[model samples]
Target: MVQRLGSIGKLLVGVWLAGVTVATFVVIPPYQGLGDAGRIVIVHVPTAWVAVIAFTVSAVYSALFLRRRRPDDDAKATAAAEGGLIFTLLSTLTGMVFSQIAWGVFWNWDPRQVTILILLLIYAALFALRSAIDEPERRRRLAAVYSLFAFVTMPFLMFVAPRMAESTLHPNCAFIKGSDCNGITLQVGNVGLLGDQKVQLLGLERQGDIVVAQVKVSTPGLASEAILRPGYDLTTRSYTDRPTFPGQRFTLALESVNLERGEARINMEAPGSGLLANQRTLWVFLASNIGFTMLFVWMFLVRSQVLSLEVQIAQRKVALA
Candidate 1:
């Protein structure tokens, strides 16, 4: 009966993921500025999120194995880690595709990209460590300790380090809004940093209902500079024209303007911002997340069961010998 229920659950997950794949292209609308390429986020983000969950699960089972010295716990931990590695690879590949379309390069050494590559290498080493050991018990013990340390780095690499970067084309704010993700405010003649660019608000000009802020942007070390005029519509209280930053696809936008105070909030926008603003896009994206999580659970369970059976068979063979 339990096996029957498990089979049913697997079938449901398969159906659910198939539906998500269909909805990704057919239901969700193309994002502003990104067009069809933005749809990659539906798969890309969920895979990365699932990778984090899988690694956390692996770490928990590894802890249990260390405390109880149970082979079953070791099997579960290995299975979860394997699933995590697979999902991480998927996330990286999808992100590269997104980058090629949005940034005109497959790899730009962006902070997020660099951190994820490092994470992949770290986890890959854990499996290599497991395979190098001859004794199963010693291998599990070492892997459990190593996995805990790897988990320690996972949070910092995946979350903290990328955000700490001064400039990144990753659209982190598009999915997860934060105070720091908002741009900077500058008054005329005041200097501020936006991403990697140093900017000074040179002046503001009003053309009827539209207000344009002339921002002088300089590269690090003041190597070069360009004047960007980002326009805001006073009547509509929205951005009118967002001009592309020099030498990059990302655009500079006037988020808000206070004419009386001679100040404006200016920010850099990547290609995929406001992607979830549409109702269909949000619903589909949420559904994709749910589906991928379920798929991860299924993979973890099946892989752990197989590993447990192998351990049991090995024990039987040793006893007979």
Candidate 2:
């Protein structure tokens, strides 16, 4: 019965993974809006997440195997490592596809991609090392030690090594929103696309060169009238803001901002040149922040209700030991 249950568990995991693969290709938003580039996210994110989980699971099993010298631990570790390598390979491949689209080249020496590839190489080495050792007891011991060492080195390679060099691919840990290391440039970049690194511009696409909306926004507290700018010009079909059109998306710059009323007034020289929006940034930001904050609060409150005791017990156990 136990063996049967294990078989069922394996079947379930297989089915779930197959479902994820199907969902990525089969169920997606409008391709023209996001284009073929968006497909990269489905495969890329899941495989990378699974790869990390696999490495973590392998580490746990290795620790258990080392403690108990059990054959089961070795088997589990081998399974995890194998799965981890496969997922890592998938991540690397999908990422390369995205890179080819965003960058002119197939492979750019981006720190994030390089680090992921290096991780793959290290895991591959671990497998080779495991095979080289023939004695059963010695093989398990060596494999556990190697896995532990590789796992430790991963942080250094993925986080430390990448930052130590120049990168164009993923956002640095320093640029991550709400991160402690976020600099002034990161904050500015978050506000303005031009202020961001060149790579940030790669992701945006210009749908049309027409002014979508125009509004005379009047704030109750300060401004009498605020011109809400459009991302593109309507009449000329060219960018209202000159020199912004040679790229994927136009950067909308406006007149002086009114901080007191919390608004910016856009002044367009041409009336026929359309630059308007149906949905304003302020509305988008407000909705996003409210939703995000509520989610955080909900997660915290729920976890506090049920998980607080478990957390407290775990802390106490740590303290006692």
Candidate 3:
């Protein structure tokens, strides 16, 4: 049974490594529509997931080590935490890139984004705290307890943040998109390692219409504005004969915008045919989130063994002395 368990562990690790290769070399870039820049998602998303996983694993190992009085768990926790932090930083940078593309700005004070920055800080502090302690047992206990606090705090950062923001650029979205996971869930079938879901954005274009200019204005200023020609019908996604005046420039309008100082809820509509806007947000959230947690569970299991090995080596060295 022990040998079989070891074999199974080896197989799982091998497959995971292979999956990482596929995720990087094949799946991520094509799926996310990230162009050359999209390659970053593979690094960013996975890093984030790994980071969260690392911290979570560290906390768990800390708990287990406390209960069992084992040294191996302590080492494993440290390794996971270290790995997690590296991935988390990478993920943040990737996100900043996407933000620049989609929102026309590199950094926004969106609650979720800000929270990630905070989480990174906490983990950094954890590392410093661990290094500061000289006594091994004391270090383990302090690190584990801190990990526990951080684990407890992380979900609040992910969830509770958006509610507190008043005027923010971040979209308040959910994970799991409420779609029948029946087809998607089953098709992707326990393929937890494969998270290459695609998000599609659609807009109809006329034969000769030109995109003249894009103006992002304050809400009140949008109330009386007509950016596009009156004849162009935005709702039907159909328009009269395209105007060739502005050379390949498409004129788009935002409805219900403020002419003076109110918020402009730009009339971005959910796709009537395919996935809705809210649905997409939820998908992005989930596709990018769960792995974050699961990664730590991986760390917790792996870390315990490493700590034991260190204890053994230390004992041998002491005996030799």
Candidate 4:
């Protein structure tokens, strides 16, 4: 069974490599400001996800080991935690590289950055505690308990804590945008699908023309205001205002304005369609996620085999005595 599982794992590793290649070379377009460096997203984001998954798996098995007193469950838990740590380290390194490009500094002590560092230390301590114990059963029991205790901090650090902070440039805009912005919803067509009916700024652009500008949408009841940069020019048909630099995140808002009719219509450009966008980002996201998940499973299978072999060797030594 171990050999068969190992063979399957080897095959999947090749698949993972292929997926990564495609994600890097084919999918995912260059982001604004990030340019080609944004390709690191394929590696960093996936590794972080795998790290979280591996830790969760370790915690689950640790709970199972305590409940049933199963040596196999303990083995699985230990192996999973080790794999999780490896991915977490990779995630941290990649994130640091990305930070250097985006924030102009390698280590800025951001909230998310500090939290991940703390997580790494916690798991490192888990391994240290296991190593100090000489007896197999005792070591397994203690490790299982420690794993459960340590896991309490995972969710808080990875998800909740970041949200509570005033602001973060981590590119996690799903929960919140900027410090004051609650959320963002793109205004499309003749009327908004959501929010109150209020046309704050009308007659800014000509009645029938394409406007290339950055639009910032603030949620309902918020003091935040939307900004359209590089004000439109009738003659040049180009943005002459403040142009966006590379790697900056901005949405290209398309709208039709008519002063006499008092009608303004706008819709966000499809992702990866603009000159600054890369279409393959979504594909890269999928490939990275699937590839690393397979890798974690493979690592677990190999580790489990080694652990079982060690157990057999120990039993044989006692029998000889």
Candidate 1: where are CA atoms >4 Å away?
A: 174-229, 232-239, 245-250, 255-265, 270-273
Instruction: Estimate, for each residue in 1-321, the C-alpha lDDT of model 2 and write its tens digit.
Output: 955855665565556546554544555432332244545555565567667767787788889989998766766776677777877887789878765654434566677788898999999999899889877679879999999988887777756886666433342221121222222121111232221223111112234533322332222122243333344443443334422112112222332322233333332121211111212322332333333233233333333334335435755887999
Query: What is the TM-score (0 to 1) of candidate 1?
Result: 0.81
Q: lDDT of candidate 1?
A: 0.87
Q: Order the candidates by lDDT, highest first — what do you get? A: 1, 4, 2, 3
User: What's the lDDT for candidate 2?
Assistant: 0.51
> Would you estimate the TM-scores of all the predictions?
0.81, 0.53, 0.57, 0.69
Number of the candidate with higher lDDT, 2 or 3: 2
Clashes of 1: 0
lDDT of 4 by residue, 1-321 (tens): 967867877897887778787768666656544466667877888898998999999999999999999888988898899999999999999988877765455666667888999999999999999889999899999999999988889999888897677545464431121112232233322223211112223234443444433444442223544544424444544333433212333322333333455444442221233321334666666777888888888898789767867877987998999
Clashing pairs in 2: 211-233, 211-234, 211-274, 213-276, 230-275, 230-276, 234-274
Ranking by TM-score: 1, 4, 3, 2
Model 3 TM-score is: 0.57
Question: In model 3, which regions exceed 4 Å deviation?
Answer: 1-47, 171-307
lDDT of 1 at 155: 98
Q: What is the lDDT of residue 91 in candidate 1?
A: 100
- In terms of lDDT, the best-performing candidate is 1
Point out where model 2 deviates above 4 Å. 2-26, 31-34, 159-166, 171-321
